[model samples]
Target: MNRIEKRMQELQQRGEKALITYITAGLPDMEGTKKLIRAQEEAGVDVVELGIPFSDPVADGPVIQDASYRSILKGTTLRKVLAMVKELRAEGCEQPLIFMMYYNTVMSYGVQNFADACVEIGIDGLIIPDLPMEEQGELKEALAGREETVIIPLVSPVSGDRIPKLVGDAKGFVYCVSSMGVTGNGGQFHAHVAEYLKQVKAVSPIPVMMGFGIRTAADVLPVKDVIDGAIVGSHFIQLMEESGYDTEKAKEYIRTFKTELNA
Candidate 1:
């Protein structure tokens, strides 16, 4: 098992859920992004979803969209993200890291080449939101040589009967989008997200983690029993943005957020 699989299994054995956090790479700059990642690892995050800034991020909410735009303006690219990951790995940061990007970035960088680069740089997995379940064959072919890189699957309320088929292909934990909209809490989660997540967990052989609209630790409580973890994105970005990228504030917020998730 790779780091992600092992980490999830380890959490399962401990009877605790994971806390996955997301941040756009090069939000302010590459140096700040690296510091934020190290801070996240220090904060006990189980998995860090490093978002590669994409111009047309249809899946992201305004909070993340703004950050992605800022990050792209600061010149974030797949190559730079991979290089940072390599540096992080070289420095002995063991926290499992995954790339969360649209498939266009992967295709633009060359699929096989991207996969190889991820493996070489020690990235644990991927969560390509726009890649349909039916169209993963091409990606799978490109990943044929990877020994441990995983492609975590996603499911939504609109997925209907395809939950089983989608989770069946998951190598790491399944990422279930908690609501119909994009990222950010929007004040509250969807009315029936808990039941829907329970259904997803029922079919997912690997653990199930809910993303989108999960901002705070309180958000995890309703779904924690039904799923394996929570993925927070826009909340973190909002925090960083509000603090104007203050290094200490970013570090403390992530630390406190992890404390809340584990509490």
Candidate 2:
């Protein structure tokens, strides 16, 4: 098993929910991004999803959209993000690292080469938001043949009968988008979230993790019993921006979220 699968399994065995944190690579700078990753691990985050900034990030909200714009303006590219991951590995930080990007970026990099590069750098998984479930055949074959790097698929509340097939072929964990729109914290968690979790869990052979609207511990606490974990992105990114990239404050936010989940 890769780091993601192992981490999820460990969380399951311990009866604890996973705290997955997402951050844009080279947001403020590469140095700050590295510090943020280390701080996240120190703050008890079970898995870290490194966001690779793309020009058209439809799944992201204003916070993440702004971050992606900043990252791109700073000249962040897929190569730079992968290099940063290599640097982290060289420093011996082995916490599960998953790269989250849009399909166009991967296409620009060549799917097979991208998968091979991730496997080479010890990346645990890939979360491509815009890639449809029907178009994953080539990427899946390439990544599976290379290593156990999980290709995580996202399912929203509207992905009805298709959920079964999506979960059946999915490895690592299934990312459930908690709401209909982009990634943000302002939106209220829908009443259908619990039911959606149950529906996905019923079909998912692997663990199911929810994201999008998840921003606070209170946002996650009530649903911990139904899902494996909650992924918080926009809220954390907002905090990071507000702190001026203060690593300590970021760690404190992560710790507070973890404490709330565990409580």
Candidate 3:
């Protein structure tokens, strides 16, 4: 098992759910992003979803959209992000890092080349929100012999009958989008979120994590029992922005947030 699978299994053994967090790479700059990730690992975040900034992020909300834009303005590219990951690994950061980006990023980087780069840099997984299940074959093929880095699938409440098929061969974990819309908590969950998660958990062999609108512990409470973890993106970005993108301050916020999550 890779770091993700082992980490999830370790959490299960300890009877604790995962607490995943997201941050746009090069938000304040590469060094700051590196510091933030190290801080997250120090603060006990189970997985860190390093978002690759893209011009068109359909799955993200205003907070993330702005962050991505800022990162892009700073000249952050897919190559820089991968290089940073390599540096992080060299620095002994063991946190399971997952790249959450649009399909265009991968295609631009070349499928096989991207897959090889991920394995070489010790990246544990990929979360391509726009890549549909049916069209995943090419990347899957590129990653053929490489099982270390698995493609994570996303399922929404409206997915209905597609949930099982989406997550059937999923590795690491299945990301369950808590609501119908994008990455923020401005709206309420689909009426039957609890039931929807139950359905995902029933069919998924790996851990089930709910993202989108999962900003705090209370947001996760309702479906906490049905999921193995929660992914907080916009709220984290807000925290960093509120701290003026100060790595130390963001780390403090994450520590406190994790305390509540585990309580």
Candidate 4:
């Protein structure tokens, strides 16, 4: 099993839920991103999702949009991000690293080349929002022999009939969009979120994680029993922004968030 699968299994055995944190790569700059990642891991984050900044992040909210824009302006590309991950691995950062990017980025990098790079750099999994389950064949084929890395599937409350199809061959975990809106809206979850997650967990072989609008422990409490983990993204970016990208401030938030998650 890869780092993600092992980490999830470890957490399960310990009877602890995972805390997955997201940060835009090259946000304040590449070095800053590296420091923030290390800080989050030290603060008890279980997994890290490196947001590969894209020009048009359709699923992102304003906070993430601004972060992505700044990162792009800073000249962060897929190549640079991959190289950075390599550096992180070489530096002994062991937390499971997952890439959250658009499929266009992968296509531009060449499918086989991208998969090879991920394997070489030790990336645990990927979360491509734009790549539908129907169109994942090419990437899946590219990753065929390499079972260490995986393509995580996403399921939303509105994904009524497609839930099974989406998670049927899913690896790593199932990312459940807690609400109907884009990331960082911090709105209330759909009325039957518990039921929705129940459906997903019933069919999913791996862990099911809740994301979107999840800011604090309170947001997770409603579905805490249903989900295996919580993903914090927009709120994390906002924290970094508020602190002017100070690593300490962001780490403090992560520590508190993690404490609350376990409490």
lDDT of each: 0.84, 0.87, 0.89, 0.91
Candidate number that wins on lDDT, 2 or 3: 3
Query: What clash pairs does model 2 have?
Result: none
Question: Between candidates 1 and 4, which one is better according to lDDT?
Answer: 4
Q: Write the per-residue lDDT of candidate 4 for residues 1-263, one digit (tens) a residue.
A: 99999999999998888889899999889998899888887877889999999999999999999999999999999999999889999999998999999999999999999999999999999999889899999999999989778999989999999999999878899999988878986857888999999999999999999999888877888778889999999998888888888878877887887778778
lDDT of 3 by residue, 1-263 (tens): 88999999999998888889999999788998899898889878899999999999998999999999999999999999999999999999999999999999999999989999999999999999899999999999988877789999899988988887998878999999888878886437888999999999999999999888776777888777899888889988998888887877766767766677678
TM, every model: 0.94, 0.96, 0.97, 0.97
Q: What are the candidates' C-alpha RMSDs?
A: 1.6, 1.2, 1.2, 1.0
Q: Tell me the spans in candidate 3 whose CA falls farther than 4 Å from its real position.
A: none
* Candidate that would win on lDDT: 4
Report RMSD for candidate 1: 1.6
In candidate 3, the residue pairs with backbone N, CA or C atoms under 3 Å apart (3 or more residues apart, or in different chains) clash, namely none
Worst 10 residues of 1 by lDDT: 250-259
Pairs that collide, model 4: none
- Judge candidate 4 at residue 230 and give its lDDT: 93
Off by over 4 Å in 2: none
Weakest ten-residue segment in model 3 by summed lDDT = 250-259
